[model samples]
Target: MQEHIRQLFSENIQTMIAAGESLSGPLENAAFVIVNNLVSGGKVICVGEGATSALASHFCQLLLDQFETERPCLPALALCNQNNSLQHSHQQDYLARQIKALGQSQDVLLVVSSSGSEPSLIKAVEAALTNDMKIIALTVDGSGELSGLLNQQDVELKVPAHRRARIFECYTFLLHTLCELIDMTLFPQQGDL
Candidate 1:
């Protein structure tokens, strides 16, 4: 059992290393977009489905609270925390409505989907586009529908793996990296301590 567990950890680490090599540029660009939006007094809206919902909420929490060092609270919201009625709504139109109502041209919309084919997430992306918000998608390879939807203006950090669990694990690291980058950019004096 211990050997199996060790193998799993080793495989996951290898996947993460491969993801880092391929996604570093896109991740950095996404961080820049997020930092620039916040610096300009814009907000960040995060949305996701299933396990990714937790990640979306965590991203918002880290930004609204703090990731590492002391700094002013950044504006961020996670759509996954919507009321139960919205969560249970038919076809998740409520989420799309919320985005349409709250999203602004200057805001950034961060969407996470391992499969990159959740209908609700796609709707949220459409609403964000209608509102002229920038989009940053964290998804895995072979994300056909989601990849097709992204335009030149959008940033897609498509991890090189196909398994959902592996993609999500990579996302966890990417989120931490994003927070660190934001802190470093905003507070260079902190020195990443």
Candidate 2:
């Protein structure tokens, strides 16, 4: 039992290490996209399902509230709900519909998924594309459908691990790192705040 617990932690740490090596450049690019969007009077829309949904809400709250220091709230929305009826509606495009209604050109769309194959998330990507928004996809792998939809303008932060737990763990770390980078970039003089 103790060895099993240790293995889980070890695996998570390994995954994070690998991600840190590969994702640094992409994450920086993502932060640049998000910060540029906010500076240009655009907002960020995040969408995910299941456990990823909760992470989406958390990310939005982090942006709308605070990450470390006190600063002006940023515009971020989470199209997340655990309720399958709303998330996986008959059309399986509920997030896409929401994006179409609220998303605008220059906005940032942050899509979180364990696998990039989720139909609803793919639709959301399509809507974001239609709206001319930038995309930052957080997924375990880029070999799925969502990867194909991303263009040169979009950023893909793929976790190095395939295990759900490890991927989710890396995601949380990645999101927090992004928040920190954004704060530092946007509030260079306000770090003590």
Q: Candidate 1: give its CA RMSD in angstroms.
A: 1.8
Candidate 2, residues 57-115, lDDT tens digits: the string is: 89999999999898999999999533466533445777888899999997999999888
RMSD of each: 1.8, 2.1
lDDT of 1 at 17: 89
Q: What ranges in model 1 sit over 4 Å off?
A: 81-90
TM-score of each: 0.93, 0.93
Model 1, range 1-193, lDDT digits (tens) per residue? 9999999898899999898899889888998999899888899999888789899999999999988877888899998534655436555665678899999989999998878778888888888889999999998888858777887878998888876677888899989888898889888887368
The collision pairs in model 1 are: none
True lDDT of residue 169, candidate 2: 84
Model 2: number of clashes?
0
Q: Highest lDDT, which number?
A: 2
